[model samples]
Target chain A: MTIRYPNGKKYVPVRTSKSQKLKNPSFSNRGKSLEDELNESNDYYLSRGIAVIHKKPVPVQVVKVSYPARSAARITEAYFGTPSTTDYNGVWKGIYVDFEAKETKIKTSFPLNNIKEHQIQHMQNVTNAGGFAFLIIKFTTLERYFIVPFEMVERKWDRMKAGGRKSITLLEFENTSVEVQPGYIPRLDYLNAVETLMKLYDDKIER
Target chain B: MTIRYPNGKKYVPVRTSKSQKLKNPSFSNRGKSLEDELNESNDYYLSRGIAVIHKKPVPVQVVKVSYPARSAARITEAYFGTPSTTDYNGVWKGIYVDFEAKETKIKTSFPLNNIKEHQIQHMQNVTNAGGFAFLIIKFTTLERYFIVPFEMVERKWDRMKAGGRKSITLLEFENTSVEVQPGYIPRLDYLNAVETLMKLYDDKIER
Candidate 1:
């Protein structure tokens, strides 16, 4: 049986045998999207009084709406709008936290084009304004997750703009970014990585 | 001539004589909605590098979309979803800021029903997380704007839930909230009011 998502993409099922799943328990969450994983993790965080982060709703331009029924107003004509900000943002430990989540199947490098120019600009602005901004990138094929700080992203972005490598290699990620471990309760434990990054920056400033 | 909006509400044009406008210059922005005022103010704040605040886009649930052309994907069926969070949120001076903007035509009191239970919960959660949360309320009839801190709002909410008055009176707002004077550049100078509220709370904490 074949299934398709609303975006017209094929929904490929993760075919892991029971024995294989037992060996690789992380494969159990292979079918979930990056967004779903983040949302579930955010929910767990909120419930545990750890953090309060939320993913902003997808933007849409409504041209026409109809009062089909008294209770339900139906939107008839609309189009998606280009988002001006990052996907997820909120407060964590009295500090403003902002990040964009991206997942790529390629294990070699994550393409710079995966993030929009405005999003980079937004992250820079947030960071400049003394807020904590970072990128939560998932290399799906490698099952690796990393939280790259805005300063690192800015340096890479400047390099990309100045005709440097158009992608950040997996080796570069391993060296620069903090890798997140997958977990059961929160799924992707990215906040732990974030805390490590924060401490690393704090130590740098002290030095 | 009658102008009707997409929502079937009549667009009431503010009729002001040139002499009246010259005497009271703020009357020029009488017709602008509270949302328009805030968006313009946010843009001004962004450009001046004062703060990074943004109004979240209206939430919509798209049911069916058609690829009419190769470029433009048209949404044919959708519905407006009840927003889970407040309208405006961003970072200010490394502190997370979150607030809801509401305008009421009632002169006597701002109705408690204007706010949802979940919204109050969200604000409380943000405040508990050490982020600042508040409401920017405009009494349209009185042409008065005030920034009421989430603490005050929580007290009122509890009072209302415990069989007190169903609404907060204008007198109560005058006593407890910080009034915002509208300006030509930012339109509504609510951030100044927010800063005042912050200091006030800080002093209370010190005491």
Candidate 2:
């Protein structure tokens, strides 16, 4: 299947051979990491004065260490830190933007466990403040992606807690969202999706 | 020495115990640590819903750990991670807030090195998007606290880069900032200082 909208030349991100084993089956275009692609796309957007977006820095936690000999102290103990906030947050054309990018192999639906309680709350707060908040779900197995707003997610999440299915089925997501074309510079051209969400929610403040 | 602020309660947080020696003079609360006081103040502000502020969890790079059969996993090695953002970022009332709190025992001034290049960029981006951005400075030797806006900071920083003095002295900060009277509940009632800054900036978005 071919994408109709964006046709820009993109640089494919190379995947570290170590991580290829964990990637979703059928998705092999792992040339550049998501962070690098997003950074490049953000620079492109920024220089043109089109929109401003940034990828939040990685979160790291360090523990005990030793400096006995005359050499650099070695990190001996540490773990990944949980970000209390989203991975990316910024303003685009006068609108507050907050989003998280995720890759999954499941072809039928996305799992709810990928979303955390604190992140849900953060998105809720963002939407409550009249900000544009959503997630970019990349279905690596199906070679597809969907951009869903908080409102749709809130509905599904509430129903799930009320004894419904734990995950959002592929059918439901496809029926609700518009497809986005993946480009070399921007792995997922999500602004097109944001445009859709903004239209639905009313775009009085957006330029 | 005691000073009353007409609110019918003590303004300064008294020393709980004056006996033990604090090895780190940067923390000059005598018997109390700066982190403790900051936590106490954040809690007070949070409970009243006046503001929601939190310290960004510190970044650590863990390298090795040993599992002890009789107890928890022992962290054997770790090191600090270079954080690209500020120490704290959150919302106060309706205005998005970003800040860094620091203490210096030196009597002359606080070192500019305390503010990292990435952190300055983050603050600049935050403020450019129309949010409240500043740093809280605690000079332990002088027993003074000052809230300096990022705009002023960036200006001074640019000058320093052009072969000027490396830092803003205590005298310069005192002349430019509001001295936040300490409190029992929220040790440093920062929002009060924020309120003053808001009036100066004349931003209508308030709590």
lDDT of 1 by residue, B1-207 (tens): 878999999997554476544323355565577889899999887887777899998889999999975769999999999887899999876778899999897888999999999899999888778789999998876778899988888899999999998999999999999999888998987888888888887432221
Model 2 chain B poorest 10 in a row by lDDT: B19-28
Let me know the DockQ for model 1: 0.54
Evaluate every candidate with DockQ and list the scores: 0.54, 0.21
Q: What is the C-alpha local distance difference test score of each model?
A: 0.85, 0.68
The residue-by-residue lDDT of candidate 1 on A181-205, one tens digit each, is 8888988878888989988864321
Residue pairs whose backbone atoms clash in candidate 1: none
On lDDT, the candidate that comes out on top is: 1
For each candidate, give the interface RMSD after superposing the true interface residues on Cα: 2.9, 5.2
Residue B166 in model 1: lDDT: 90
